[model samples]
Target: MTRASYVRRTSEIEHYFDRTALAAWKRLTGDQPVSGIRATVRQGREAMRQTLAGWLPRDLTGWRILDAGCGSGVLSLELMARGADVVGIDLSAQMVSFARQRAAELQTQRSVPTAGRVDFRSGDMLDPRLGRFDAVVAMDVLIHYAPEDARSVLEQFAERTRRGLLFTLAPSSHLLRAMLMIGKVFPRSDRAPAIYPTDPEQLAGQLVAQQHMSGWRVGRSQRISVGFYTSQAVEVVRS
Candidate 1:
């Protein structure tokens, strides 16, 4: 697809989630498991969470976090529980609404000592109006964008972060690329955004190893598997 069309389609993905927020929540938190595709998506969600959380700070007391693609507040909840003030952003109004609801539920259902000032906003991360934070987290979001767009997001997050930036991607590989191409045959009724695996090295170069960002270092997280896709994340730390 052309770059502009890809971006438009990527942004338009929120429409799919507006209709499938429940299913998206399943893929975000894996709180409930149904058979077939739902089960598989839940499994993937759990795996990704486990892998991503393993690399995060165990105690985020008083830290301010920006959850760039906070789908349904999955990671935002975790960060809040770890004692971080979190700002979660997503493109889908439904997803952001669900995330807000989940954040509220988290407060009432338990003593939310660490659930500090959690806020959910419906906006694209590429918006120039966004502000900086102690750390930024964008998990499994870049899979919907082309390489250029993915790189731009990385740079933008890096520029805004004060301490670190953590993110995951569906990494491109020879076999995986071919697999994605083949999967296009089975049409999906959900009309989800096309998943485009990105290159880890490209992300690292822009966010970590670039001369312009000379103070940053790279920390790779464990790979996460979701059957239809694979994820690899990195924590870009300011050295």
Candidate 2:
């Protein structure tokens, strides 16, 4: 494999986390505002929320949910508030810090003054330290690896999941590719170097090959004036 395809180290992801957090916070709160990044964050958040809404149960009480590569813990925090036991892991230390801080802020804002049911960890998705989760969601991630490595990562995700999986990828259409290209050219985008453009079909095939799921269902929503598609896959495992 080329050096570009090598898995990015935690330090690299941490730097990424630091960059995106500043942008996301500025966009979300708008107290410290950037018109451009705010637009990007709004789009991304909408895409992520649409993806999460597709796979998540109407109520997740007492369920175990894992957010892999969970930057800023957006879905993780939401699931915890719904009474799921949530665990968020990221290779980026900065992301873990941001998630923890966000969780704290959320706890303070609630009328019940309750804490979130989330545990944040700094670790690679491939590491065994993560144990297992009932459902795992990794959004806007996995595109950083080469196609082969991406398949391996999906296999790893399958091993850890007891119920379902949800994830996002760049859309397969030519229009969507052009849109992503334009977005990448935006100032300070900090795009992942090895991000090979892969669509839901390719990813679904990979998961099926690993027996992670019998098949995958594709869905999408628009964000940031772009189309973001999600792949939802389910595997039946015998107890």
**Relative to the true structure, how large is the alpha-carbon lDDT of every model?**
0.74, 0.61
Q: State the lDDT of candidate 2 residue by residue for 102-142, as single tens digits.
A: 77776788732233378898777667777878777776666
lDDT of 1 by residue, 34-59 (tens): 66766666677767776676667888
Clashing pairs in 2: none
Backbone clash count, each prediction separately: 0, 0
Q: Candidate 2: misplaced stretches above 4 Å?
A: 1-6, 9-11, 19-32, 111-116, 173-194, 211-239
Q: How well does each candidate superpose onto the true structure, as a TM-score?
A: 0.84, 0.73
Candidate 1 Cα errors over 4 Å, as ranges = 1-10, 20-30, 182-190
Choose the strongest candidate by lDDT.
1
Candidate 2 residue-wise lDDT at 148: 64
